[model samples]
Target chain A: MISALRTLLLCALAIAMLYAMRESMPGYGDITAPIAVRGAVGERVETQDFAFGAASVHLARAVKVESFGRVKDYSTSGVWLIIEGAAVAKTETMTLMSAEWQAGNGVRYALSQRFSTVSGYLPTERLEPGLPRPVLLAFELPETAVDKGTLLVARSLVMPLAEELSIALGDRKPTEIKPSVTISRSAGGAPWTLAAR
Target chain B: MSEKRTFWTCLVALIVVLPLAFVVRAWESLRESQWLAIHKVDIVAEDGAPQAFAGGQWKLLDMRRLPRSDDARIILAEFEASPTDPAILSQGACRVRLVDGKGRRFEPVALAEPAVRKMYPEVADRPRCGALAFTDAKGGAAVRMAESFIVPAEARDLSLRIEFPGASEETLVFRWTRS
Candidate 1:
């Protein structure tokens, strides 16, 4: 009986160890930071180098654009953007989103579709909804374009699944966020403050 | 002897196989690049007048008389195509876009703040856009603060969609802000 009990305990210990290790795999992807983007709309720059570089030029001085709706509930970004005398080739902003991040580069990136309802928010009902949400990522350019004139329409970015799990598991971080961009120059030469939440 | 030997072998296998299994699972999660949802928009202008309206908020603060050599109190955004023209002191407006180093494109999704734009379809396309300056005979010059805009912090990595008037599409192509 003593020997049989010891064997059972050993088996249980190994199984528990395996379970813990499996659970730890996702956290190995503990993503912490939010990724942001800035964009603009203009003509393809004229260039001879063959590859798209800054010198390749486009020409436009004014533009206007509008977007609205929620990206997620906890977040809200919707506005109508009007650019005056803005160079088409100049940097611009459109939208920004963030979720709880993983620690390493363990993220799986796939071209998944999003669906929005009349409210413009991602529905809590289904993952693959019937209606297609206009995922406008195909318009994103290179990082080099993140300069001035960049206008983005941010709505709601959901808490990453990992972060949500952490919260559910009682791990929460402070909400006071330090921004990546400085307030040196305003978008439309307009002086404004980024009221952080 | 048989039972003792079997127990010892099982213990060894448990330690070795467990670590090896973890190593394999860990390797499966690595990715070459991070894919982010974003878009690219570029703009350019050619009037030497500062752009007052853009996709975000903008204010015209007259700081020309503030002090000398400080960021020009006047602001010009070279979001794209940094001018390399030697004789072209100012080519008017410039371009801007949002992109990640890795190859992926975003779209004009939403607007975080308010913005505006101006154009003179009837004017001769040159001289300058945004703000312009002429070199005084003595070399010191006066500055003109024409247009400017304020970009919001949340506008990054998002697709920019602008509304323009009279264009064939009325939707000013994302990169159509040109010089």
Candidate 2:
């Protein structure tokens, strides 16, 4: 009877040890998460694939995109955040395929698809090595989530073990929001400029 | 005593050997699936000679650098491939890129680009590296291909790398000095 009890106790101890190990071990998602390279607005962050710098962040009530002699206006119930930046591919030609606006409260907002027709949308623009190109990303977010936002940039949404840039947008007051903004798309390696209206 | 020894061996195998083998296999699979995984055999071209790779003969016909209005330059690479086995064409498109001395890689620009169309009008007539399979060419007929890239002016010692979907494990590299 004593031997059987001792065996049962050992078995229980082994099970407990396994349980502890399982809880402490990193999960698949955590192990494969993108390597994040953090930076602030206006600071150039270099990753394994590319280098990116966020030049300015603007908040507007509405956005007008001028593409190929046509102008399209996009108005949102929430505020529109325009992020102007430059991206340079380091080793190969690539595109910034994913961008997200993470609010201070941890709410993530994806890049607005309403302006997909815009020719110079950042996510749609191709980046070539050793050549710097202007980037413009627009996100629609609630008014409360405007201040203290962080822009998350990555090569792809599902990339594993790739570098991601997290650019922090400093705090801004409600008064800084503009009434309207216009983005003029340029042609043939020209930089796109944004104007406040 | 023999039965006792056999029982202990079985226990050792179950408790240690089996799990070790499984862990090793899983680790290998994870490494292969990672983003930085590279599994390619490289074949370098010497003296502009044609190379045999992926059941085809590849040769670099011409490489030229053209000055652009801007500081950037255009690299036009023209190559040809003669397939020994025509069935390889069905394996999908080929990927060709230029690597500079500084390890920067440049992908081919669209054939419809204004510069490519204006400077190399014949490029529009030739099939791209991977599009040869779609043509009605029989085996051993050399099909010409062309690619153009916009590169920085300082890029030098350029090499062209070609990859075919049919031969996923092999790549051909043609090296040339900027003249």
Candidate 3:
């Protein structure tokens, strides 16, 4: 009887250990989380899918876009942050579909959808292998979150386990916040250009 | 003796059978998802010959590289498919791409940029691989397709690949002589 009881206890112990192991396994989100590639502003960040280099960052109160002889002006209560970068696909032709501004306090702001009609937007343009093209990303964020923010770029925002490039904007704040900025989209000249308004 | 046999059988099932069953279930799930399935290219046309794939004969007609001012070049690929079975046309749109020797896959440029349109106006009229299959071709006629890609000037040894998702598990790879 003692032997049988001991056997029962051992069986229970094994079942408990198995249950604990199963419970400790990682969740779906944890298992399929994005692989992050980190870099700093002004430095070229290369991922398995693409290469990106952020050249400049502009902070403005309002934005004016000139495209196809039509000018559209946009104003936001929050500050307008414009990111100018160059992106090239590493192997295939693909679109960079996700851009977000991650504030220092961990708040994330997606790229503005208001500029969807504007040409040269990074997310809408197709990227080709070996051909680097200029890309622009605009984000509207609270003034308090402008300093010490990071820019995140990825081929997709919803794809699990995809590569994500994070470019840190650094701790310094901008010296000048333009009252208005104009983005001219001309076919004969560069894809688009930014100027103070 | 009967109790000993029962204990051993139960122990064996707990140690091995349960985990094996879970693994088999996971494998089936992955295969059913198709996204995680291994892409095995079954048909390869290496000698510039037409290949029978997806109930059709596929041939790479022409391929050329056009030099641009920058470090990038435009790769134009023209292909054709002569269907042996008309059912292949209704099998849904096909996915096509260019794969280099180094395992780099290039998707076709969707939008016609001004530079590419100015250089190759004829390409603008030709349908892509997906649309070509559904074009107004009657009586098993050959459907011509074209696609353009902006690849790095140094990209070499490129080949075309076409895949029909629900119709066939095999992928068709066509190699072309560079002109």
Candidate 4:
């Protein structure tokens, strides 16, 4: 009877300790720290690249292609905004980084599909340190989205599922998240400039 | 009497611990199962020239910015096209289909003819509409398929379906965000 009682008491203590440490543990909830950094166009901002090395983005401009051949414009109610820029890598080799544009209206537009077929346009390019890779990420959005939108360029096209799982399982170290870049139209509206971080 | 009492206690402990150990082993096995072997799927704009069947012939799709109502969005998707066999040049054709949030099914424009011409323009009238294979530096083969489909401006959610030869059909969901 005494031994049984002791075992029960020990189990209760273990359960209590686990409950107390739940919040302190990494995978307990979604209350983790923000991983992205914020910066403006033209100004090169360093981002969290994990083991791929240091990365920087320079937002160039937002342009709308009026027409291509006899097909006319594809977007009926919206226009395609081709975000032109370059990303430079330092140290390690990098894979294609997915880019997304979030308008001030809260609508998020991914890279455009129509314009990717155009020659000399590269949306996915491996970035190695030294050489700057030209970025031509396009987004299909309403004309209202052009003037103000935040551009997010990250290594994963989708949520980092593997990393999230590893972090939850406590199997791998958590990777730092770089800040997203904010893009705004210039005074004359010819070019989009990155907002100050 | 004391010895009998101790034996009963020891047997009870063994019964509990043995089941716990089996449960842990089963959990580990499930975690390592092949059900988790889903390949990476990516949706991006078709780079270079997009070839599609137009006017009873294969032609290069114009890189035009068309309205969603007028023309469908042309997107390129990448997947693990590496075949288990190195001798297999083609991994067969893939059927690309999409279903919108509102239950609207959108079939990708016909790509078989264009696919053949793009890969083997020199070979005339061949109907080998399989995925175009390219060997990487590591001698592993990868395939690329260019497909076009229409998505309404108000589409809240989109699910892309890809059916490769000899493999189960897979559906990839695109969760759209308004803000």
The most accurate candidate by TM-score is 2
Query: lDDT tens string, model 4, A85-110?
Result: 56654433455446667777777677
Question: Between candidates 2 and 4, which one is better according to TM-score?
Answer: 2
Return the interface RMSD of model 4.
18.2
TM-score-based ranking = 2, 3, 4, 1
Candidate 1 lDDT, B68-119, residue by residue in tens: 1222111122221122231333322322222322212222212211221222
Where does model 1 exceed 4 Å of error? A8-197, B1-29, B33-119, B122-179
| Regions more than 4 Å wrong, model 2 | A1-27, A171-175, A187-190, B1-23, B30-39, B89-92, B131-134
Q: Is candidate 1 or candidate 2 better by TM-score?
A: 2
Docking class of 4: incorrect
lDDT of 1: 0.26
TM-score for the second chain in candidate 3?
A: 0.79
TM-scores of the models, in the order given: 0.22, 0.84, 0.82, 0.32
* Model 2 C-alpha lDDT versus the unseen true structure: 0.83
CAPRI tier for the interface of model 2? medium
Worst 10 residues of 3 chain B by lDDT: B129-138
Comparing 3 with 4 on lDDT, the higher-scoring candidate is: 3
Question: Candidate 1 falls in which docking quality class?
Answer: incorrect
- Point out the worst 10-residue segment of candidate 2 chain B by lDDT: B130-139
Chain B TM-score per candidate, please: 0.24, 0.77, 0.79, 0.37
Model 3 ranges with Cα > 4 A deviation: A1-27, A186-190, B1-25, B29-39, B111-123, B131-135
lDDT of 1 at B133: 24
